[model samples]
Target: MWDTVLIVDWSGGNDRGASPKKDAIWTGVARAGQAEDPVYHRNRQLAEAWIIQFLTDEHAAGRRVLAGFDFAFGYPAGFGRVLTGSDDPFAIWDWFAAHVQDSPKANNRFDLAGQINARFPGIGPFWGNGLARDIPDLPRKGLARHGHGIAEKRAAEQQAKGAFAVWQLSGAGAVGSQVIMGLPVLARLRQRFGADLAVWPFEPLTPPIALVEVWPSLIAKTIAATCPPGAIKDAHQVRVLAQAISALAPEDLARMLDAPGGTAEGAILGLGHVALLEQAARAPVLRNDCFALPQGVHWTPVDQALAHLRQHLPPVAGVQPQPLAAAAGQYLAQDVTALRAHPPSPNAAVDGYGFAGPAGTGAQRLTLVQGRSAAGQPYDGTIRAGQAIRILTGADLPDGVDTVVMQEDVQATDTAITFQGPLKRGANARAAGEDMAAGQIIARQGRRLTPADLGMCAAAGIGQLLVYRPLRVGILSTGDELRDPGSTIAQGQIFDANRPMLAALVHQWGHQAVDLGRAPDNRSILRGMLDQAAATCDVILTSGGASAGDEDHMSALLAGTGSLALWRVAMKPGRPLAMGLWGGRPVLGLPGNPVAAMVCALVFAHPALALMAGGDWPEPQGFTLPAAFAKTKKAGRREYLRARIRDGKAEVFASEGSGRVSGLAWAEGLVMLPDAAMTITPGDPVTYLPFGSFR
Candidate 1:
């Protein structure tokens, strides 16, 4: 129900009495259809001040916000009673508010944790403050002589596998200090916002500013691969969480906030969005129900879903066998074993004379035999001790012959051959099974056969191969402003480029591209075409009707007859990438802008289609080169600028608009910008991915 979603990656380290420097606190923002770059915060105080002011400004503008903090908002059920003299978590929040102290330079998290631990009678429910040298209650490690605090983990933490115990107050991966330092900020937020803000699980979630507990680890596995290497861990975490939360639909978000027993660690959203969609699509086969899912969630991550699909989705089910010549570009459904050894038997490697025994000394001459050995015609008789047989290249070696000298180094006459050079035992001869052995696995199941693979199978005597059928792709273009190229020109109408471009790309990728034709803004026509495409094609691709414009019909169509998996991915020039399933077939809705549509198709749709076609997704190949241009980019959204390599440097297009189709035509590749706030200097290193790699 919110218009803006913010994810906070908080830290509890003592900024050493100064503002945090790096790997500290990070915050990311995602609006209804736009994801803002993440902002770095040096300390909790600054972060709190910014959040308060930002939320105030947004609320003043009548915008609703869903803000999630990455820290426990409450303690375990019974611990709340011991800490605040009540079983209610809100009471503990109030207690922390009154007891904790924070500033840009320092915080009393360790002292407060020690104070709270003293009430419980043990070393911990709170321990580990390496910064506190003289603290009696909170030791750096191990229990004190008289310490015995409870070691209870919150239900949400336990449900989130690999989650650290909340009692571990210090050391690596410990969130206890964060809980103590962060709750005070939440308490202040609640006080300032009052009824405007609602803490999930503890308060009614109907407020304009909802505060929910979040664990980035819940969605980390799904997005980790997409994140750039050597990126700041905290910044990356918040960005991923923001993207995941922004991608969730309304119903799915509600189910996550409504999860049971999330009062302590807070309700983790974006962890169940995938599950809700899976449930709606009746694709629960990938869900493992044994683990405790937050409330109605039976979800799996995108990587997990892809893996499951790759494993269980049989190679085009019941595909027919095809000849080796027709197997190129298709996935092999069965393993191919070598039928016979290569070179069937030992053969000569060159046209020469075969000698019975090795040449004892240099300049040795031998009398030639009447029989000759040529390819496909071997002599029946063996050579005598002082005689040699004439052998041609690829001819099988006769009995009593072990080596052959090159014809160029020998003198030959009718019925006689002479070699004047010493011969090695096995020189110039190909041994049986040298290239391939009998019963060897030349190709395994699920391998996409290439031309070389087909030739290898042919050499191994495999005439036919069992392979998956070709993937069928249906392409569509939607919008009244879009008209087929070469049609009569009309006012305010642009020739359609997305359909033909996408169709050609699909074909180049070895799929059968079916042109579903151009669709107007009419819902009936769009729905009919979508229905037909879903029923007949393996995947449906469309452009121009995915946004919120009045003419946008893809969203409504998916909402009515299908389930939209994700909307508005956190990407520049291509935020409006809508993905879902219609009639059990996958649909990738790209943007209408030619440049954005092409980039989205390559970066997202391309890999997705590969996975659907029972083939491994191709990783984007790139090389590092110095940038020949300079620009400032935002963090949290990935951008691919039309660029090319010139003078050994990467150069970008002059204009950065997604509608500039000429940029794609003018550039040979793209310059990839990671999701971060940074200034690119002319000599700085940039990643360049050639367009040919995608093709």
Candidate 2:
């Protein structure tokens, strides 16, 4: 049997009406076994009788119910009016309060007090006597807190006594106003009711509601009344409706709901429809919360940790560059000034003959003067008619010379030159400040320095540039049974490969890696090395000694020093990872097993380096590849399998032990298998994460 959900609208309206325009009866019937759906008529006597009878019936049935409503059960009488003006209003609580005030017991002191006290137990004195007193200037600062406290208390009473899960949704108006007025009340209820009182804002046009609200009238009719099993024909129809509603896109729905005339009531109905459809569709419900590490917990989700760090880290300030050599391959420090401190005197761009003419395009011949002018030198005397001077690129054009015929264009005849084409004023001439202007942003902040950028800065008379300092990473490995490569192992000792692998990884990320000598299986010596590294390096990474075994002393040392942030992450192979502060510096402890250490480092170290380098961390790169062979897995934790690419598909490599170094050599990348997915057939798309050049 499925759980029952009740959607109650306490506003003044009847489910059925007689007149075509006035009669508003819902003809549709709710699926069998669901809770009662009631539209509380504004008629106080009738509504009170109906509510009492409904509660009596529910109490006799002994079944728990989850109720969703459009109004805040704990809202102060005038709170809604304050947010949404009373003229364009849909104030449920206000109507109820007015109805209560005008009831037959209006003259009865006990009845009036009970009505007010039901929602605000101790506030009758303030409303009735405080303003009437001579000292009416009493502080009202406690009113808001008092109101919130009462709302929470009432919501708790509803949940504990009635076994209810109450959901309060907002209507159309100022969204900010609704949130401000509604959230505090809902939050108070949630604190006491726990999951039983799940409160989320319902935007009618959002995906979740659209998916469920497709047939709003039908769902609303069904929820508004009780019906027998045969009246609705098939119960699965409800499920189908729910599934379809749940599948609608949220962005599209939000657009629709945000349109004019979209009201809180409309949004509530939309959400109710969605919920009903989901129930009928038999869709799975997902419970999600912001990622966080519990007290004393070790390994945390990499995304969560990175997000927290970003919030706490201060903004990086811009700095000027040091020198040209240091600025090589770096972004420009600032905008470059123009090549010359002041504008250059007018010059010619080409090395050719200069001449004086009528300053227009139609020109025929020019006599060449024997004098020559090279760059940085100019012909001092003015040119005569039909006369020209030999000039080089960057040399000032003599006065009265408005054009330069290219050397190729001039046909030399001893001391004279004949022009084949028309010559125009200002043609082939380099104007002052032609390349760049002074004080322009020649280089922007945060841009990577390129050859063109460097050249431009140098041309602008800048010799140095400022850049972010490189991140420093220290790599260390621990194990008495480890030996460096090329050194013969004695007895049970194995080769130390983690240090080199990690160092290479750090360098690939553009960080400076300092290789700290290996530590034997001694806690005191390991602690001292870690302390020293933490004092100098931005991040300290060590392999081995993370587990809780006798040889696993890294966790202990970290705990004794500063503070241990996390000791273990809920990941495979790298489950016993450690993260903490040592002597005010961050430390990451990886498992001693070669493959495990490398994978963990990729998952964590790469992101840390990017953050420290003043760059946004890149998303984990994933590729789709077919499974080389069939594999079975437990349906809980994510799994990564080492595989090689063959024929554009992933081929699983045999021998995947965490301690096996040969596995790393054979595999090109790792394949991520999502949790709750047990088997994947050949040709099924699986995400491949590359570790080498393939990335």
Candidate 3:
């Protein structure tokens, strides 16, 4: 039996500027000893990388990995003949792989669908595109107005109700885009992994990584009522499915995978639907398919293949010396040791009379000494027997004198003093090195010097210190639709919010904020801007044009000219992060949506810049507060809800969208939801992080 089961609720929507927590693609994983929580992915490119990395890691640990994707793996049998001149289901996969254009920001699904529709007798067996994407003949909505387009339902869809036509590319119930977009990725994965991957029903399950089609709706109805309110509907569905599979008997799971079936688009996995799956899996493998795994080949898991990638991450930047006066908030590069012992020599801790041997105890009269010991003006001579010196606080303790009696505790007359209270030896005197000994470590490297820490350094005779220099951060925004905030707005243009906001944030974090301004949609200009930023700044930040869309020139530039180190992180309000090196300097590409841009800047870029500036990475510190709202979250990805503390509880925004900047503006802080599959309720303690902490 597989030790790890992964389920993905695939999306065909434009996820370029989506919130990570609620994107079109939601992935849930269930490990033998782990809790179920789904992780969200906005950019399919990054998602692919993460999936490959995850599977590689899991297999390296010797755990069996079973993954499911929610989409039609193949079209209805006859349609494959019409589309690819063959009944072999894999022909369509090969066709898509040969033609589909996919990137971090965009895809060619609509255009390819139009071309496919043109080849058919009439309007699409494929249809639907927004007004902006209107093709020559396809209708924007509803059924095909004309054409001999085939509408035969796939066998799996016929088994399940409310299934959409594979011909519809836009609107509700449309799986056309998904098929066109998802198949290409699958083909790539199949080709990349070769014998290591197997597509269920189409190929024999001899490999370690098995790709299966899943219809969440098939088992979702059974657990709909059991799911808690406010929980993400899709997340709950995938979680329940993974849970059911993990709870099944090993023999039962094997039987389900071996189930027989007729048409592709694949079988839905569920313990309740085991009979159907077993029949499908056991069905004779389609030998006629253009794509098939070779028999008798061993496969490597994704986890094992990518294991070394994690260990060879880029190192943090070098350190620089900074003066003590300019070192506030800067991380120390070296340890600070005390120059001399605290209270160099014994001194009076109180204003009193210093005498020999405590004046022999109890009410003894002592003659006055020749000198008085005051702060900064110590008595040079030693006190003789039966003599006392008048001393003030912080004055050096004279030789032969070990105790001090406050004036209030003794009666003083001309040239003499009479003790009224008992005096102990060394009373009211601060000893040398009592607070800190010489050569003691005052602060260690990587510690951000605080006010109290600075005071300590000053007292230890440290007038200067070594620290990391401030990081020079350059902010840039792309897209022709973005204009300066105060500029006149034309039709289809919005004021740019990311550049100014990120620049201010960079400054607030004590880094040099270099405004590279906005780059137009032209690739060459964008490349020029990036080069300039790289020349002057240590790190570069940009929003928009990071997706795979054709107009997304920033991504094209990075993918073509620079090295892309990271593409996506499993986080909410921030998912699409294009990280790489440009001209030997690091760059971070944020989503175009303002709220997402801000969230990603804080969560991902801030810490990275800090590290490059020779500072220790800071983790968000949170406090537990009662939840005023209820929610359900998937495991594997972290999310932050724009929320505020109200009536001593955390309340999330009424609307949740990456574009909702007003909600972020209204929020005082963020409610941190961990990467765990669980439900939260009112009055439950949730971790809350204030903006002040991050800023």
Candidate 4:
């Protein structure tokens, strides 16, 4: 059962700025048992960050989170394969995450729509570009284009009249931009939370976090009639919808997540049908205050921000019985105890003669038994007092042999052996189970099996083990200005560096690296690949399209689609990271810059991936070192500088600029500066993280 319910009314337009306004991003969050007023934000950035923090807090409090975003999670079915080269519905989210660039003052949604239209022979499906910008292929009116390639509305919308088509990007009740822009956020959230986050319809439901598409218009009349005249209508609608859903039993939400025979595009989760809204319209909207945070709070502490991830993000992988031969790097699902003693019976620790009891002071001579004992072969008869049997290292001690004397310390003759006096009992003789006892646990659950662990397991007579499945991480990238590495590059395009680096990073982390493929700046193609990616991987790591730039599609697409949680992480090289769920998988949307992407992946994603992979959250262990150079920065944020150890001190890279990819090669590790404003001079101690430590 969901312990927390959140309703979000998303807007695709630019930031509303410090003032309260209608048609902005508004959200209503209510615990399953509580009623609350919806919260409001001026822009997607703040709203997303707040939502993420809220979700994190709820998870920390052991609450199951269900968030409903007001947008289509997908476009029509044929539209997907036509636009993205895939039939999976969530491919659109991937498409949007790759191609849509957005900022408060501007966005390329209309341009993206125009680009999508150009992919078809003619524009007939999408319509209405009300923006002042003259997009090439997109038309100003629905009638301007013809030869419809796909249906204008989804099956869910067809059952509910007065619902606007997903193609309507402008004019009254258009939700096109809001939709594609909202998906990347979900894709990111899926990446960030890993197995802990899930989506509706496309994937099975899971606890802690889940996302569902919503439409406030399903119950707009019910909310409008009951709201006070002065209140913002967007805020009022979300509050009412949240109330209706929260009032429902747990099974009702489950049914919505698994809508039967869902449409090719998406289904609005508000009422499941127009009739349900009609049935609930008579109930008045309530005014209640729910979860609220202090206004204007920004720049979360870096440690506090990323530290909470492991505490709540549970492992999404399942257990499998794997032979020790193939279980390296996989986490254990159960303990592996010893099946037999390491040395099953007492044996000679050294090549020596064995006899019963201790020897008296002074050199002593004893007669040796006729037969000798070697590894895997033991003397058949028991040794009597004053007699010794020849033994080899690792040979089982014969009966009555309590001690052994090394051959190096004895003079041997044909029938007798002489050794030093005052030999202690059991000296140089291995007792049974000395190295390991039977029934002793050799390795515990959730331990990442290493070469040593496998060796120990083998010695313990364990041939197979139950291990958690390795996390499958999909790596994706997007940008028109980007071209594949080693490909012929155009004048303006740079080779794609992020995807390859991230894929390598994923591989280095011991998780399965899935190349989700790359797409040009077009949205439809990206969507097809994204849907394929979501279907293929458990978590995704996307570099580029993660920032507020007009070309940043990853974060924008997620805002209104799945659950987008923006983190205003206070750190240099990387500050903002987009996290969300797309089609029930986790996604971590990283900065476009290569340096920032690598740093963020190390600082945040590594431990997160480990925890998601059924292993303990591991923090990089760094050592303090003296600084060979001096530097200073503002105190509010922590900073990481690429540096190398020179003459026993840390020497920073020539420049602090992130674009200097050469710096990454030049430095051996990173020197971290604390949050306080302080200058580092030569001889000052600072924390240094070597590249090896992260892995």
**Using lDDT as the measure, which candidate wins?**
4
Q: After superposition, which runs of candidate 2 have C-alpha atoms over 4 Å from their true positions?
A: 1-322, 327-436, 441-456, 467-470, 488-491, 508-510, 547-551, 567-577, 613-657, 663-695
Model 2 compared with the native: what TM-score? 0.44
lDDT of 2 by residue, 534-592 (tens): 54565688898877777777777876754554445545657666666564445678889
lDDT of 1: 0.74
In model 3, the Cα lDDT at residue 636 comes to 68
What are the Cα lDDT values of the candidates?
0.74, 0.51, 0.72, 0.77
- Sort by lDDT, best first: what order? 4, 1, 3, 2
lDDT of 2: 0.51
Error of 2 at 55 (Å): 75
TM-score of candidate 1 versus the correct structure, residues matched by position: 0.54
Question: Ten residues in a row with the worst lDDT in model 1?
Answer: 282-291
Sorted on TM-score, best first, the list reads 4, 1, 3, 2
User: Residue 474 deviation, candidate 3, in Å?
Assistant: 0.6
Full-model lDDT, candidate 4:
0.77
Q: Return whichever of 2 and 4 wins on TM-score.
A: 4
lDDT by residue for model 3 (1-695), tens: 56688887777766645565543677788643133577778877767888888888886886667888888887765677787888777778889989988776677787777777777786656667844946776677655546554655676677667776677777777787878888877887788778888888777777888888877666544547657887777777677666555434344466667757555546655434533332222212111111112344233122221221222222233344456777898777668899988888898898989976554545688899767999899888988888888999999988888888887887887799887646667888888989878999989876777889888888787888866556678899998888998889999999998888899888887778889998999988888888777646656888987767788777777777436533455667766666555754557788999888987777766666665555566676889999999999887667889999988999999877999989978998888787768799999999998888875
